[model samples]
Target: MTQPEPLPSAAATPAPAEPPSRPSLPSLPGLPDLPDSHVDAVELSGPRFQTEPAQVYRELRQRHGPVAPVLLHGGVPAWLVLGYREVLQVTQDAALFSRDSSLWRLWSAIPEDWPLRPLIGEKQESILFTVGEVHRKRADAVNEALFGIDPFALRDRSERIADTLIDGFCERGSSDLIAEYARLLPALVLAYFFGFSDSEADEVTHSINDMMDGAETAVESQAAFYTACRELVAAKREHPGADATSRLISRSPTGSEEEIVQDLMVMFAAAHQPTAEWIGNTLRLMLTDERFALSLSGGRRSVGWAMNEVLWEDTPSQNVAGRWPTRDTVLGGQRLHAGDLLVLGFAAANTDPQVRPDPAVSTQGNSAFLSFGHGEHGCPMTGRESAETIARAGIEALLDRLPDVDLAVPAQDLLWRPSPWMRGLSALPVRFTPGPRTLG
Candidate 1:
């Protein structure tokens, strides 16, 4: 059987170029549009992403020549950078492409019901939207906190959590892997790091996932998230622990409780769903691709190898939005004006013929694509290691327990959540021989 091939054959080849873009169209534009917003912007959030992002990314690549236009949450216009080298140019050259959302042109024009307001608004205190000195200050604290994490201990905790979660369904012989395993493992692990009780992990994940869905409840979910983080911060301050959150509280430069709370919130919010979804994506590979499955489960290939493949092909965030241009610039022959918002097409860039060219071989670093982001805004020291370890140990425990696990439903029937920026399976139902539960 053919290996996953890093998301279909198109990933190994350059996306076919489309006919010239047509400007002045009322709806999303065709491929021929040139020079940044010359044609209408395509909608980034929709069924298209939920179904096939690689296919959609290839189409977008063909359509606008890599740096094209896309409408964000609430019909906001922005450039979607699809080329690998172009993504590198935008993310690495922070001088030209700033993370500061203030430069985002649509911030002021967006409607009150703007769906991504929490993610992009200035009121959101996550370091993701900061730039320059402010970002450095935040990153410093985060980096230190991440450094304090004990990976060995973290891995052990993750395995135990995975075993616990599997016990909830192993006896039934059928389960939605996404909800029961992939999604829960990271949440519980993160709750430990954030110094919350394991029992609270489900609620933490539910709130973050709700925010990711951007439903009517999302606003209220985020507000509740704030309150939880604030409480966690106070508890950590009053009675410190060795967890990552306590480290963050001690290292944070801010005296304001609000700033401290934002730091903790971003840690849990940023780390949970995206990490969980990507873990789900990796599990999908194990279930669908026989060669990949055998290699991973048989110990010939490590989970890290499979994970890199997932990041290359089925990254959690297909199109991470909102990198505003700091000045008028030209990227891939596309003219980008100052404050022109740009979305980094991580999946598309990973497949760019100029970058990967051959999925059969592995790319050595995270910088190979924007999966973990780049430059000042990249994930912290223990971030990648901690995440990979958790995913690996959790999956390993399950595979050890249920080597015959396979999809309970057809792969095509599985659906992903519909969000403009991220890609994640809504549920992954699986069936395995009924087995005794793992003991505590």
Candidate 2:
């Protein structure tokens, strides 16, 4: 729950005291290393994400080089990998940075009620926890379901859904973009694809919200999520349709109901938040940045350009948890335990000087950013219906239709959710001239 990076403090008084720059932890003989329990629990929504993450990350980079130690929600210590090349080296090397829970040192120490349980905890065996052959087998079924979808066609359907959602608010000349458009579209799309009815989709979205937001009832919501997914899977199995759930169930090598349900749950859970945040953040970028607004609106710039820039500058998921070292190793001049937990700072790495001295160049292509990550454990949304395609399509639907759309409030006033793991807005109130329903 710590900030991605802590920034230099702002002194409101006459003078500001300089925080002693501790660049690297001392690994001297007989000197005790910093304990994970000692690191502060500064949640993302706790005034850090809005005002401090970038600066905090910058300070860590200046001090530690690339990877630095930080405390997760439960006083669980882990290394936050902040360098671009360093992140690539760690994530790409499966033998070194294993994703298997067997290598996670801090998981056992974490208390049951830890607030980040929903984000970091996995009660059931899913693709996120396994590695090697296990991951390959489980991933094949999930990938067949995910990569099988057509992105261009999915975009068309998502656009139609976006239009319907907009129609609800178009008359008022104002809307909460996050709630009405960004969030709802994916829920509806995923629900339809998984064979859930409209009412079920609404409830599924509710459970998904509770789970993703780490609400106090998250664990309960996760249970409810499992139940809903099982029902969906069961129905699909009995009546086998063209939906992803049906495909996943039929293709699964294990042929186990529990495993099938877990995989289905993972697919929905993974897609919901990241995809929504990408749309919301990308829209926020297009609206707030005048150059972006003008260029994209006028067709002088491409949606692909805006999407790439947002992916690099403000990654939808700032912190990716659960990358552990398979053996004792030295990272960023600090010694790591064999099974120590480490975080991948996707946003920080995207900004690492070694990767891109000028972030604006991110729009130019090359696609080296770790936001989608790489290697065997990379994002499953790799094919056409990827975040990039969905976001571009969704953004086009809104901007192309509502060109006058602008922030209803000052950009500075917009709020960001406090969960340290995600980079998302609480709401995006937008106002545009009343537009007609795009749907017939």
**Model 1, global lDDT:** 0.74
TM-score of 1: 0.88
Candidate 2, residue 350: lDDT: 81
| Model 1 ranges with Cα > 4 A deviation | 1-36, 295-302, 359-367
Q: Across residues 1-440, which tens digit of lDDT does each residue of candidate 1 receive? A: 21111222244366545433232223222212334454445566556676777777776666568787766543456778889888877878887888888886545556555546665655666777777888888889888888888888888889888888899998999999887888778878888877887556677777776776666898788887777788888888899998888888888777568777877777776777778887898888788876577854475355666677788778886767668888888988788789887878877887886776666775545536568876677777468787778888877787788878889898788888866477788899999999998674
Q: Can you give the lDDT of residue 281 in candidate 1?
A: 86
Per-candidate local distance difference test: 0.74, 0.74
RMSD of each: 5.3, 4.8
At residue 283, what lDDT does model 1 achieve?
A: 83
* Residue 259's lDDT in candidate 2: 88
